[model samples]
Target: MRTAYSVETVRGAERELMGRLPEGALMQRAAAGLAVACGELLGRVYGSRVVLLVGSGDNGGDALYAGARLARRGAGVVAVLLSPERAHQGGLAALRAAGGRVSDDALRDIGRADLVVDGIVGIGGRGGLRPEAAQLARAAWESARVVAVDLPSGVDADSGEVHGDAVRADATVTFGAYKPGLLIDPARERAGALRLVDIGLTLPEDAEMEALQHADVADLLPRPVPESDKYRRGVVGVVAGSARYPGAAVLAVAGALRGGAGAVRYVGPAAEAVLAHFPETLVHPGPPDKAGRVQAWVIGPGIGEEADALEEVLAAEVPVLVDADGLRFLSPQRTRERTAETLLTPHAGEAAALLGRGREEVEAARLASVRELAAQYGATVLLKGSTTLVAEADGPVRVNPTGTSWLATAGSGDVLSGVTGSLLAAGLPARDAGSVGAYLHGLAARRAAGPAGAPILASEVAAHLDAAWRDVTD
Candidate 1:
């Protein structure tokens, strides 16, 4: 599992780790890894010109010290000090001893450099980069390949917001652990490639955020035994679509069938359309409450005017996943009163409407928005977009890594809702179901798009989900 910690938690751990080690031991460990990564990026460290954007923080020290190591290896290294007086004296001295010189002309030095190291701001930085730092950053990006130390300068470490000008690095060398901003957007776009350098700090078991890899998803994936029967494996009830948008019902049922659930019971006016596409589904005409026994229920995907079903679905004591039109009819009080887990799947526009905020606001502040929605609704929230975020109140937010831009189709969200609801039926926790479903949903889109990078329909994503499951479990 790839995990991230908050700025405060990381700072506390850093303090604890530093107290046990020698005065400069931790810095040396970080610098050594930084120098090695820079060397690899440059290919030939000898004769390559490297520029360090030195600031008044430990990030500046790391860059300067790494520059000294490169200088010793015959690389022509120059340090551009943004704050010459407050810069790390020990690091500066080491650079001088190893034949690295400080330059006053930031633009010229950055333009000619083979690699530019961004040390202007650390994780604690806010309000983007300073004017002078931003100028140097722009210059470096225009000419040389830049490597950011820790996080890309100017992005919020906790919320992943780039309020102003920030560094656009070719790669970022992070120490200790990853930050939320590195994994999230629009700050995530600033960090091109990420490399974690272990400086040996024991972080808490409960991380602020996590990205599930194949192994993690596989572990959470439900499997069946030989003794398992249809009802024993679990049945997921879906209340979706109407006469106008019967395709939504079919697509939702398609995803549920392949979601490791033994059975799918669909309740809606689109039974004929759903049965025509997916005959395996147990279809009901209306009123989801009377739709037989089910371990879990998925409500609202193109239910448009049929919001009455939302109440019937909520009355069931089983875990429920509400999406699309269902989210519109939902209230915090409705979920707060329920004892079973409730998962809310909403796209940026829907989430924005729920909070009475603008769509752009929700899109820009996805991490914060997801957290707030989860807290307010008292449900696990899957905020779908270019990058999918799954959050639960008082739990580490899970960022889905396998998402592709191709999954941004009209009915893709309905498929995700069904898949996650099926996982809930299979007895996965609300948080795990949301994370795994998003992972599988994204992976299926990638597979459907193929290596040709062609466009795919929502139906193709549903079709390729079994392949995605194999890819994960294999």
Candidate 2:
């Protein structure tokens, strides 16, 4: 797992580490790492024209010290002090001693530079950039490949929100540890490629956010033993579809069949459509409880307004995953009353409706919205979007790293709900079920999209799950 800490947590870790080192030692360590990363990006550091957009913080000092290293290696290094009066005195003196000059013609020099370093702001920065800083950020972005110190300027280090006018780096050299903003978007989009330089800071084990690698996903995936039987592996009950949306039942069942569950028992009005698509499914009409004993129930995907079955499924002692129209019937009291685990999967519009907030508000503060929903409902919540987030009431939120733009096609959410529900049936915890399910679902979309990245149907995403599972496990 690739974990990220909050700004406050990172500050605490940095302070602890700095206390153990000599007076300028921590900055020197950071400067040394930053210079190496910058040098590698520059390829031939000798004779390369480098410009540093120096701010007033320690971020500026890192750039200045790094600039000195570049200057010592025969690179023409120039520091454009955004705040001349407050720039690090020691760093400035070091640069001057190494034959690097402080230039006032920032824009003119930036345009001709081979590489530009962004130290305009650090991870501690919030809101939009100041006017002068914003101008320099734009100049650096348009003029050359920008390398950011710690994090891109003006991006929220905690929530991953980007205000107006921020620096766009070709690469970001983050010191000590990864921050939450670096893994999420629209701030994540601004942070190009990421490189972490360990400065010997010990953060808490329970980080604020995390992204799983293939190894993590592989560890979470359920595997059947030779002694396993149909009931032993797990049975997932799916309650979905209506006359107007029969295809949703088929898609959900398609995803469930490949989710490592022993069998799929589907209860809905679209029994004929589901049977036609997946003959292996145990199909039934009417209430979900009568559909037979199930370890977990997945309710609501194109169920329309008929919420009669939603209430019955929620009453079941088994773990339940509520999604699509099923989410409409959920109440905080109803969810909290249940003893079993409950997972709510909602896209932005559904989440907005549930929270009584505008879609724009939820989209703008995705991290906050998802966390709020999880606590309010007292259930695990997976907020679906370009960057899918799985947040429980507490603990680190898992950000899914694998996905493609092609997943925007219709019926993908239904597939995701079914996949997650199957994992719940297979005995994974709600958080693990949600995270691993999303990891596989997104990887399935990437497999379906192929190298061409052609547009694909939701069924294609479901069809590719086996390949995605192998890609992870193998």
Candidate 3:
């Protein structure tokens, strides 16, 4: 798994490591790694024109030290000091001793440079870049290949929020470990490719955020034992679709049938369509309560304002997954009163409605939004996007890394909801169910898209679940 720690945790770890080392050992280690990465990017370091955007913090010092290393190697290194008076004296002196020069014309130097290193702001910075820095950032982006030191300037390192103007780098070379923002969206979008430099600072096992790898998913997935029967394996009940949208039922059932669940019992108005497509499904044209025994329930894909079905499903004694129209009538009060485990799968627009905010607000601060929704509703939440996030009231947020952009098609959420509900029925906890389901769903989407990748249908993604499952287990 690829893990990320919170800023507070990272700081604590850094302090502990720094205390054990000599006065400037940690900075030198970081500078050496940074110089190596910069050298690799510029294949011929000698005679290469490198520009450094120097800030007042240690981040600027890192850039200055790295520039000095390159200058000693015959590179034309110039530091454009954002705060000359406050620049690291040790770093500044090292640059001068290495024959590197300080320049006031940042824009001009940036335009003519082979590469530009962004150190204008560090993890401690809260807001966007200042006017002078912002202009230099923009110019650097257009003129040369920009490499962000640690993280890009002007992005929230902990939350991945980019409020105003920010540096858009060609690549980011992080130190010791990756910050949460490096893996999340908005800020993640600005961070092109990512490289981690290990400075040997040991962190805790429990990170603020995590991305599941293939082996991790395999370990979490439920497998059938010799004594396991159809009923013992688990049964998933799906309450979805309407007369107007029978295809939603077909798609949802397709996903559930391939999940770890031994059987899929579908209850909805689209029973005829579901039976026609998946003859193995046990279909019932009635309410969720009268549908008979089920280990877990998945409600509202295309049920379109059907509050009665949603309420009945919510009141079930087992775990429940609510999606699409099922989220329309939901309230914090209603969700809090439920006795069973509940999971909410919401896209940005639906999440906005639930939070009483705008869609952009939810999309911009996805980590904050998911955590808030989980806390407010008192349930597990799976926020769908380019980077799918699963959050609960407590514990680290799980980020899915297996998704393809081609997964953005109609009925995709319906498939995810069914797959997650099936996992819940198979006896996984709500949090585990949501996280594991997202991992497989994204992997299936990638496999379905194929090597060259084509615009795939949601049904194609469902069909490829078995392949994804095998790849994980194998």
Candidate 4:
């Protein structure tokens, strides 16, 4: 798993590490890593034009020291000190000694530079950049491939929130540990490709957010034993679709069949369409109460305002997953009374409705929104977007790293709901089910989208779930 720490934790770790090292040891380590990354980006460091946007803190010192290293290697390096008087004196002396010079024409020099290093406003910076800094950032962006020091300037390091102008880098080379902003969206969008340089700092066991890697997913995945029969593997009951949109039932069944369920019992008005597509599905009419026994239930996905199905599934003694139109009928009082596990899947718009907030608010503050929804509804909540986040009332939030922009198609959520519900039925806890389901769903989407990543249909994504499952297990 790739873990992300908060700003406070990173600062605390840095301080603790610094206390045990020599005065300049930590900075030297950081500068060494920074210089190596810059050299790799430039390919040929000798004779290459490198511009450093030097600010007033240790971040600026890092850039200056790295510039000195590059200059000694025969690269023509220039540092545009945003704060001349406050620039690291030791770093400035070292740079001058190595043939690096401070420049006043930052824009002109930046325009022609092969690589630009952004060390302006470190991880502590908030809101937008100053006018001069913003102008320099823009110029660097237009001129060359910009690399951010710790994080892209002007973005909230903790919340991943960008209020106004922020430096958008081609790549970000973060040190020690990953920041929360580098994983979450909005700010994550500004951070292009992320590369972490280990300077050897010990972080806490618990991170603010965690993204599941392929190995992590492999461990969490459930496999059947030889003694396990169809009933022992667990059965998932799907309550979805209506006469209006029968395809929703077919799509939901498609996801459930490959979701590690022993069998899928589908109960709804679209029995005909589901049976036609997936003949193995055991179909029933009307409410979920008369659908016979099922280990878990997945409700709503084109069921319109079907309050009856929602109530029946909630009344069940097993885990239940509510999605799409079902989220509308879900109330705090109704969910709070349930003894069984409940998982709510909502997109930004649906999540906003549940929280009684605007869509923009939920999308902007996804971490907070997911946590609040999990707390308010007293259930596991999955917020779907560019980054799929799964949060429960108590555990650390799981961020999915395997998504593509092509996953924004319609009927995708229905497929996800079915897959997660099946996992829940297979005896995984709500949190694990949600996390594993999202990880597999994203991997399946990426695979289905192919190498070029052309637009793919929702059915294509569902069809590739078997390949995605094998990819993880193998």
Q: 1-474, model 2: which lDDT tens digit per residue?
A: 999999999999989988999999999999999999999999999999999999999999999999999999999999999899999999999999999999979899999899999988888898988999999889888889999999999999999888777889999999988999998888888889999998889988899999999999999999999999989989999998899999999998888889988999999899999998889999888678788999999999999999999889889999999999998888999998899999999999999999999998888788999999999999999999978999999989999999988999999999998888999999899999999999999999999999889999999999999999999999
Off by over 4 Å in 3: none
Candidate 2 off by > 4 Å: none
TM-score of 1: 0.97
Question: Quick one: ranking by lDDT, best first?
Answer: 1, 2, 3, 4
Model 3 Cα lDDT, one tens digit per residue, 328-401: 98889888888889999999999999999999999999999999999999999999997889999999999888
Task: For candidate 1, list the clashing residue pairs, or say none.
Answer: 128-154
Candidate 4 structure lDDT:
0.90
| Per-residue lDDT over 1-474 for candidate 1, one digit per residue giving the tens place of the 0 to 100 score | 999999999999999999999999999999999999999999999999999999899999999999999999999999999999999999999999999999978788888999999999988988978898899999999999999999988889999988989999999999999999899988888998999999999899999999999999999999999999989999999998888898899889988999989999999888999888888989877677777999999999988978888887888899999999998888999999999999999999999999999999998899999999999999999999877899998989999999688887889998998999999999998999999999999999999998878888999999999999999999
Spell out the clash pairs found in candidate 2: none
The lDDT for every candidate, in the order shown, is: 0.93, 0.92, 0.91, 0.90
Q: Which stretches of candidate 1 lie over 4 Å from their true place?
A: none
Positional deviation of 365 in candidate 3, in angstroms?
1.4
Which candidate model has the greater lDDT, 1 or 3? 1
